[model samples]
Target: MLAALWAAEGPLGAAAVQSALGGRLARTTVTTILTRLHDKGAVSRSRVGRGFAYSPLQDSAGLTARRMRNELDKQHDRGTALARFVSQLTREDEELLRNLLGGAGDGVRGGPQPGVGDGPRP
Candidate 1:
């Protein structure tokens, strides 16, 4: 459902989304899923007639990153969790991360960020 919305050029009504899915899911089911996504902050909705038009708030990669951050936030030992996660990353991913971090080294680009309460995390 989210993929369907993400693929849309603009916000879509439930009926449109259902049609996009080839009607495999009922309109109510699509509406329900969109509602759930809206509640989860994964999508945004606008009043459309008596119903609403929905659009994905983030692309797939961004959604995955948000989920990862949420999961990390839930951990009691975030440092340990992040360490383990980085430790398990494939070489390519590890290198990519290092490059990203390196690029962010300068404050203007998204350098090392201040901790919570101090400022935003890059």
Candidate 2:
């Protein structure tokens, strides 16, 4: 459902979403699902005639990152979990992360440093 909405050029009515899904789901089902998504903050809706048109609040990548943070928040041993996560990364991914944490190609010579204000802000 979200994929249908994401692929849309703009907000989509439930009927449009249902049609985009090849009519596999009923319009009522699409409306119900869009309502649920709006309640979950995953989508936003605006009045469209008697019904509503929905748009995804986050893109696919943003949604994935949100899910990752949610999963990490559930872990009691977050440090250990994060360490394990980093340990399992491929060399390319590890280097990419290192570059993201530091500056590009700076390498990991220095340990954790104080905030340089380059990371995402609340």
Candidate 3:
């Protein structure tokens, strides 16, 4: 899985990854997951002998956000879907989202951001 690739010091072959993960997953399953990750642009792969070696293209949070966007793309009403998703956020999360969106252009300053370090805005 992605976690396996993330933990690897460098690109890893599917067999090595499967073995490292306690061999709970078949090598073929690991290959399939790696292929999927490659297709998702979360990882890059290259031929290594008869098999492929894979390496992560992004950090965990970037990979997770890409997955979230892919899931969002499948919804019929994206606005409703996003609204419902946002509605479920805790106050702290909401504040974080608001600040992140608001600070899109201006680089984050030295001051503590809302809901960060200082807790949610009252």
Candidate 4:
């Protein structure tokens, strides 16, 4: 649904979205889904006659990042959850994550150090 809106040249009405989806979903379902997406801030919408036309507010990467952030926020112990997440990452992924957080290269303090040791982390 979001993909359809994102690929559209402009905001699309629910019927258009439904058609873009190859008509696999009913029009009412498309409208309901769009309404839910609008409620969740995943899409922006404006009135089009009696209904609304919607467009994706986030690109694919932005959507994925938002979902990751949302999932992180749901944890009771964020520090532990983050640590566990980091611990499971591959070295290349760890480096990418570190660089993305405003650092470059290796041996950086507070960066994820994958497969460093069997000993406890600093």
Q: How many clashes in each candidate?
A: 1, 0, 0, 0
Scored by lDDT, the top model is: 4
In order, what lDDT does every prediction score? 0.84, 0.83, 0.83, 0.85
Give the per-residue lDDT digits (tens) of candidate 1, residues 11-53.
Answer: 9999999999999998998999999999999999999899999
lDDT of 4 by residue, 1-122 (tens): 99999899999999999999999999999999999999999999999999999989988878987998999999999999999999987766765666656654444534345544334334
Model 3: residues with Cα > 4 Å off, grouped in runs: 107-122
Candidate 4 residue runs with Cα over 4 Å from true position: 103-122
- Give the winner by TM-score: 1
Q: TM-score for model 4?
A: 0.80
TM-score of each: 0.85, 0.79, 0.78, 0.80
How much is the lDDT of residue 120 in candidate 3? 45
Which residue pairs in candidate 3 collide?
A: none
> Residue 12 lDDT in model 4?
98
Clashing pairs in 2: none
For model 2, what is the alpha-carbon lDDT of residue 1? 96
lDDT-better candidate, 1 vs 4:
4
* Stretches of candidate 2 exceeding 4 Å from the true structure: 104-122
